[model samples]
Target: MTVLSQEKPLPKAKTGEFWDHVQFGGGFGISAGNDYTDITIAPSAIYNFDDNFALGLGLQYSHLKQRNFYNSNIVGGSVIGLFSPIEEIQFSLEVEEIHVNNTYSDLYNNIKKSFWNTGLYVGGGYRADNVTIGARFNVLFDKNKDIYGSAFMPFVRVFF
Candidate 1:
């Protein structure tokens, strides 16, 4: 006699699967000297739609001082999009906007200046595990009003 066996179908995936793909990453820095002080904090989160695509948001804050020269506060936010064409390469595009407030001091006077700045960055980097190292350029960089000395910046990112 011959017997026949049947296999059951697999179950479907549950809802709210999007939350499973979220990742977080950012960095901070602090420095102080007899005549200078700088502090920065930035935090960000991203949601991966798939293995190769992600969208995210970030926040930034910085405090800087030069004794008897200038003191400044900077606050900003950014929106970023990431794509990985292969396992080892990733590319990104980001838009950032920040407000800067500066107070300058001299022997006899104090001056205050405030303004908003925006940057559009395009970059690519090498990826390994949860880290990416690369350089980015600001398409909207203006040396006169931007905080960075140059339009190009190097970055290292880590996510889990």
Candidate 2:
């Protein structure tokens, strides 16, 4: 009599393919000075289409107050595109549209204004397995709209 051998099945993948997963993270920043203070929080999601390209979207909120003078609130959304030809570096470009509300108070009068504005940012930076550190420039910067005081900005991100 001859015996037959049984075959074993391969393990199944739980999360599906590499492109099927999404990465998420958020960032925060705060600054204080003698006459001014600013705070910002941004949350984002990204989907990698492949080893070299990805796309993302983000939401932003910012608050600014100056000593007994004026205060502003901003809310916006952004879209981003990223490319990495090398393993440890990547390039990114982003565009954002925001709405700003400002209120000013003084001995004379108190006034308020609201408007919608847009900004463009382009930069490149070093990237590791789950973190990236980069500096970007605002290509479409307006002094009234860019509360950050400069066209150059630095950023850090983490993905899971």
Candidate whose TM-score is highest? 1
lDDT of 1 by residue, 23-121 (tens): 999989999999999999999999998889999999999999999999999999999999999989999999999999999999999999999999999
Query: Model 2 over residues 89-153: C-alpha lDDT tens digits?
Result: 98999998989999998989889988888889998889999788998989998886665588898
Candidate 1 Cα outliers beyond 4 Å, as residue runs? 1-16
Query: Considering summed lDDT, which 10 consecutive residues are worst modelled in model 2?
Result: 12-21
Give the whole-model CA lDDT for all candidates, comma-separated: 0.95, 0.88
Q: How close is candidate 1 to the true structure, as a TM-score?
A: 0.90
- Residue 126: error of model 2 in Å? 0.8
Q: Would you list the clashing residue pairs of candidate 2?
A: none
Clashes of each: 0, 0
Candidate 1, poorest ten consecutive residues by summed lDDT: 11-20
